[model samples]
Target: MPARPHSPCVEAAPNGSFFHPDVKEAFMNAVTTEIPALAHDAGVPPAPPEAHRTADELRDIPLKRLVASPYNVRRVPPTGIKELALNIWKVGLLQNLIVHPMKVGARKAQTFGAAAGERRRLALIYLFEHDYIPADHPVRCRVVPVEDAVLLSATENEMREPMHPADACDAYRILVEAGRSIEEIADLYGVHPKTVQRRLKLARVSPKLVDLFRTGEVKLDQMQALALSDSHDEQEAAWFDAEPYNRDAHAIRRRFVRDEQSFVSNRVAKFVGVEAFEAAGGAVRRDLFSAAEDAWYRDHALMLRLATEQLEALGASVLAEGWAWVKAMPERDHATRSQFRPVLPRRTEPTDEVAKELAAIDQRLAEIAAQWEADDMDDEVAERLELEEGALSMRQDEIEGSLLVYHPDDMAQAGALLSLDANGEPVIERGLVAREPVAAATTESGENGDDDDDDSSDGRPARVAAPAVKPTKGPHSERLMLRLNAHRTAAVAAALAQQPHVAHAALVHRLLAGEYGHSTEASALDVTFRDHSHNLTKHAPELDDDLAFTMRREQRRVWGGVIPNDSDALLRWLIEQTDERLLLILAQYVAASVDSVRPDERPHAINALIPALGLNLADAWQPTKAGYFDHVSKDRIVDVVSAAVSPSDAMRVAKLKKGDAATEAERLIAGRGWLPEHFAKAEVVRMKLWDVPAKASDAEASADEAEADEPALAVSADDVRDDAAVAEGEGMPPRD
Candidate 1:
C-alpha cells in the first residue's frame, strides 16, 4: 500500500497530521481493488440460450421499424452514449441490440424504440449525428417476438444488480402507480421496506439535484447534506458552505461529513440570541441539542455496536460447536447471547417421532368422537363441531409442514405440544395432531376400548356442545370493602390523621372517583382546616403542631429543639430539616459514614427523604404510590441550611429528613456560638471540594475511551472534561 498523504482531503487543517498511516494505506488499496475482486468471485452464470434469431439476421431492418418493449425500459447512463459510440466505431456492437417486431399498423412517422439495449440505441443515434457511422448503418439487432421481448425485459431488470437509491425511489413510485403493493415491490427489488423509504426520501430532494445524483457526478453523502436543509435556498447555502468547489461532486459524498459542533452552536445562538436564550420560559433554558442528548446518542450507538459484536461472537461460537445441521438458520432468528441454548443431539428422526405421536393422537380422537356421538346434538353444536374439525386438520397440516418441528420427542420435550387457551384450559395441541384418522377402520376399537361412530349413516353427525356462558353482573359498587381480622380501618385512619401534614384523615365513606382526590367526607375535613387557618390569620397565626395534632413527647422534643419556629416557611424549612436517625440508618445499610458517600449521593438521599418530609406528595405521587418531591427548590434548602453548618454536615442533615440535630451538633463542634457567616463559607468550599474527585474520575474514564479510538479524533466526554479541568485549574470558567 502506498503511504498516506499528510492531507487526505484538501480542506484539512494545517496542523492536522497523518494519525494512522498504515490503516489509511490499507483502506485506500481496498477501495480500489475490492469491487473487481467481488465481481470476479461472483463469476458469470450463463444466460438462457438465445430465444430468437441472432442480431445479424435483422441488420437489413431500418432503425425506424423497431419499437421499445414497455417492460424493458431502464435509465440510460449519461456517459453511455459516448462509450457506445466509441465501441461501435472500433469493434462494432459486441452485445447485439435486442429488438421486437413492430406492430402491423405502425405509421411511417413511428420511431424505433429500444427493447433491451437502450444504451446501444442512444449511442447509435449519437454516431449517426456525428457522421462517424452511416445513418442507415446495418445494425445487428436481436429479433424476437413482441410478447417474448416484454417478458425478457422484465426478467432482465429483476435479476440484474439493484438500481441506485435514487433510481430505486423512482422505480418504487412507478411500481405503486402500476398498483403493486409496497411489500411486493420490496420483495421484487430485494430490499427492505425501510430501504425503499430512504430511497423515496432521496427522490423527494430537489429535482435539479436528483438529476446530478442519477448521473453519478454527485455522491450520496453530499446529497444527504443538501437534504438536511428545509428549503432550496438553505440547501444551496449549506451546500456552498460545506462544499465550495465541485458542489455536485460534494453533494454525492455528503454522508461522509458530520455537522461541526461550533457551527451548529453559532447558528442556534444567532437564531435565538444570547439574551432571549437566557430568558426563555420554563425548561427551555438548555441548548436544543444538550450534553445529555449527545451523551444518550453516544451511549446508544456504543451499545448497538457492542450488541452486534456480541451477536457475531455468539454466531462464531455456535458454528464451532458442531451445530452444522442448523448452519443455514436465518440470521434474524439465530440465538443471541442472552438466548443461547445448547443444541443437544437427537436420538430419532423428527418425522418418525411425529408419526408415532400422530398414531397416539388418532387413538384419543376415536374416544372423543365416540363420547360426542353418545350425547344429544343440535344444529349450532353440529356447526361448531365442523369448525373444530377443520381447525384440527389445519393444525395437523402445520405440524407436519413446519421445519420448526424436527423429532417426535421434540414436540413434547420442547414444551410446545400443548398451549393454554384464553379460558385457561389446554385446547391447542401440537403433538401428532388428533383428527379424522381416529375414525378409520385401521384404528381398532377394542385395542384402546375407544368409540368409533360412523357419520355417513345419519345426515347429522354427533356435535360437540359449546360451554355455557356466565351471566354478566352490574358495574362494581363505588367502594372498596376491606374485610380484615383484628385491626379496625378507623384506628389506622386515626393513626394516619395524627401526622404533621394531615389536616384530617378518616375511613373514606365512599371510594374517591379520581385516582388521588380525597372523598367528599375527607374533603369536608380540609374545608374545616382551611376555615380555621383563615380565622387565625387575623392574629398572624401559624401552623402550631400542638394545636393542629397531638404528638408523643419524644417526637415533640426532637422537633422542638431542632425544627425552626418560622411556621410560615414550614414547607421550605421542613426540607432544610434532616433527621440524624435516617442518616444513621442509611449509613448502616450502605456500610458507609455520612461523610464518605460521593457528592451525587447527597442528592439521592435528599430525593429519598422528600416523601418523609410530607412535601409535594400530591403532585409527585404516581398511581403506583412512588413519588418525586418538588415542594421547594432543592437549591434554596441546600443554600439556606448550609449557611449554619459544614457542607458535609449539611449534606448529612439534608439527607436525614428526620430532624436537624446533626447540623446543630456540627455548630457546637465549631464552637462558633451562632457565627453563621463562617459556617456558610466552610460549606461552599467543602461542597465544591467533594466534586473534584468525581470530576477527575469522569475525566480519567473519558481519556481511556479516547485512547482506544486514538486515530479517530472524535469529541467525547473525556475530551470535554480534560479541557474543562485545565480551564478551571487556570482560574478561568469552562466554556459551554
Candidate 2:
C-alpha cells in the first residue's frame, strides 16, 4: 500500500494503529482485483451457457418486475439481507437474477418472477425503499421459461457447491500477494474489508494446520482459532497441545486468552481507562482478528491497582464533602449496598431566581406538548421539537432537583460510596447511611416522622434476634423486591432456554403433569413465553454480562443465521428442521418467556428445575453494595452471612456499620454457593399420574430428563400445492 492521506477511521483500532504494513499492502492489492467470481461464489448463480441465448437476452429489468417466485425451492431465509443490500447499494448488483415470464390477469402489465435470485431482488427492493437506489432500480436478469426458472432456482441453491474455506483463504492470499487491495476484494466479494483480512489471516496460519484443514482433519472454526495468533509456531503449539476431544474452536481460543484479563468485559479494566494503564507501564495485547471492543490486558494486578488508586482518590474527595465516611470499592455491582439506609436530601424550596427559571422552562414544555398534540408533524420536525422539549423539561427538573440538597446533619450521619459504575466512570453515591443498630431500626429512616410513606419503609429489620426466625425474608420494600425479581426471572429464563429438556419438561408439566395429579403450580410455566429482553434490560441493566444474557444473545445470533425472513418460508423451513433442532429452539423460546419475578412469591416452580437445568444463580449474580444489601436491611446481610458462613461470622459482621457489614458479607458469601433465598429450589413431590405403577411413574417423572426426540411433523403435500396461490397475491405473478 502506497502512502495515502490520513483517515479518522484508521485511528479507531484497538492498538491505535491499523494492521501490519505487510497486511496493509495485501489489502491494497486485493482492493484492485475484479471480484465477479467472488460474488458468484457467494450464492449468485453463474451465467448460463452461451448456446441458449445471445448477450442481448441478458437484459436490465426494472426491480418491480423481478418479483419472487413460488417455485424457488430454498424456503429457508438467508441471513445478512441488510448487509447484502448495503453492499449492492455501494457497488451495484453483480450477478443477474434468473427471471421467468409470468402469466397474469388480462389487464395487468407484463412482469417476471425471480426464480433463482430472490435474495438479491429483496436486497434491491430494500435499497430502493430506503431511497438509496432509484424507484425503478434496474436489476440485471436473464429471461427464462417457467420450468427452466424453477430448475435454475433449485439448482443454484442446491447444486452449486460453495467454495471451500481452505480454497477461498488461499485465493484471498494469492490476490493480496499479487498486489490487490482489501477494499477492492471486499467490493468484488460483497463483504467488509475485515472479512478479507480474516481470510488472509486464516491463509497465513501454520501451513501444516492449513494442510490439516484441507484434508478435513481440522474444521473451519478450528482453523479460524489457530489464525488468531500471527506466529506460526504459536499456532502449531496450540494445535499440538490440545487433547483431541478438547480441540474445539473455543478451546483453542481459550488457550490463547487463558492468562489475560478480558478487558472489554471486566468491570475493573473499564474503570481504569486504557490510556491510564499504558501510562502506568502496563502491557496490552490487541487481538487483530476480533472486533476491538477491548483488548487483552496483560497485567491483571496492575489493572486492579490502577483502579484502586483511582477509586481511593475519588473517595478522598467524597470524604471532604462532609460525609461521615467514604467507602471505595472496585466492583461496579453494588449489590451489598442494599442494606444501607439512604438519607433524604433536605427539600427546602428553590430560591426566587431558580424558581423563576423552573417556571419559564415548565411553561415552554407545556406549549411544546400542546403543539405536539395539535399538529401532524414531519419526522425531522417532530424530532427537533421533541429535542427542544426534552431540553426544557430537563432544565426544569435540574432546577427543582438542585433544591433538594444534603443537609449538614444528614451528611454528618451518612457516608458516600465512591466506586466505578457500569461504564467504568467513578461515581459517588451520596447520603448513604449504614444500617443503624436494631434498637434504632424503628426510627432510622431519617424521616423524623416525615410526609413520605415510602421513607418509613426503608431498612425494615431483616430478621428477628436470638429467637432466630428463618432469615430468608429480606427487609426490602415490595417495589424493590419486584425489581430484583425481574432480574432473577430474566436470569432463570436465560438458563431455562439453554436446557431444552428442562424447558420441554416445564412445558409438559404445565400442560399435563400439573393438571393430572400435581397439587402445586410449581412448574413456572404460564403456558406462554414472550421475548422480554427489552423490558428486562430496562429493569436490570446489570444483566448485560449475565450468563443468561449471553446465552440469549447467542440464541438470537444462531436463529438469525438460519431462519428465513419470509413468513411462508419460515413455516416451511421450520417444518423441515430435525426434531432435535426444533426442540432445542422451542426450549429457548419457551424459557425466554418465563417470568416469575415477583416480590410477593419465591420462584418455586422455576426453582424446582434448578438441579435439572444445573442453573447457578451464584455464577450469574453476586451480592454487591449497591445492587443487593443496600435495598435490604443490614440484618438480611447478616442472615445471609450466617447461613452461608457461620453464626459466628454473621455476628462478627453484624457489629460493623451496615455498609461495612454488607461489604464483609459479600466477601464471606463469595464462592459460598449462597444466593438470595427466593432463588432456592423448593422441595417437590410432584406429578401424580392417573394410571400405571404409581412408584414407577413418579420415579420417571422425577428423573432429570428424557432425551427422546420430539416426534417429526408430518406436512401433507396438499399444504404445499396451494403455495402458488399464496405467491400470486404477494407481488409475484402466476409463474407456475
Highest TM-score among the candidates is held by which one?
Answer: 2
Each candidate: what lDDT?
0.37, 0.66
User: Model 1 Cα displacement at 662 (Å)?
Assistant: 41
Q: Top lDDT: which candidate number? A: 2
lDDT of 2 at 51: 22
List model 2 lDDT by residue over 195-262, tens digit each: 89888888899889999998999998888778767789889988886567557775677667666777
Cα-lDDT of candidate 2: 0.66
What TM-score fits each model?
A: 0.19, 0.37
Candidate 2 matches the true fold with a TM-score of 0.37
